[model samples]
Target: FRGRRGDTVKILWADADGLCLFTKRLEEGQFIWPAVRDGKVSITRSQLAMLLDKLDWRQPKTSSRNSLTML
Candidate 1:
């Protein structure tokens, strides 16, 4: 996991064949993280998608009520 000071982190996971490494970094800003006293925290699918897109995943925007009806 990355630190609050814009540190780079590399995570290794066990795959079916071998180990897989995933790296993440921010060029301009730091990644939004959850405030938890525990060592680990769970993130939602939407949060993960936002993180991958280099967005702040902490505060997710709610969907608008307006919708288009399909004919």
Candidate 2:
């Protein structure tokens, strides 16, 4: 999130005894920030995946695949 359009994103992380940094850039669509509070917020692994795909994080699960396979 340190770069602009067509640029690169710089992500810095720190753990127990090590520090890591990474970068990524999207070819289209602006980055969509998730809801936040006064302080930083975190999401679960499944929530993160939905956010990256720009889908509703709170969507209910359906069994459409089960019906389709039965047809």
Best by lDDT: 1
Taking all chains together, each candidate's TM-score versus the true structure is 0.62, 0.47
Q: Least accurate stretch of 10 residues (summed lDDT) in model 1?
A: 2-11
How displaced is residue 22 in candidate 1, in Å? Answer: 1.0
For model 2, residues 4-41, the per-residue Cα lDDT tens digits are: 45234455679999989876666765444445667555
Best by TM-score: 1
Per-residue lDDT, model 1, residue 39, is: 79
Location of the lowest summed lDDT over 10 successive residues in candidate 2 = 1-10
lDDT of 1 at 55: 69
For model 2, what is the alpha-carbon lDDT of residue 65? 68
Off by over 4 Å in 1: 7-9, 62-68
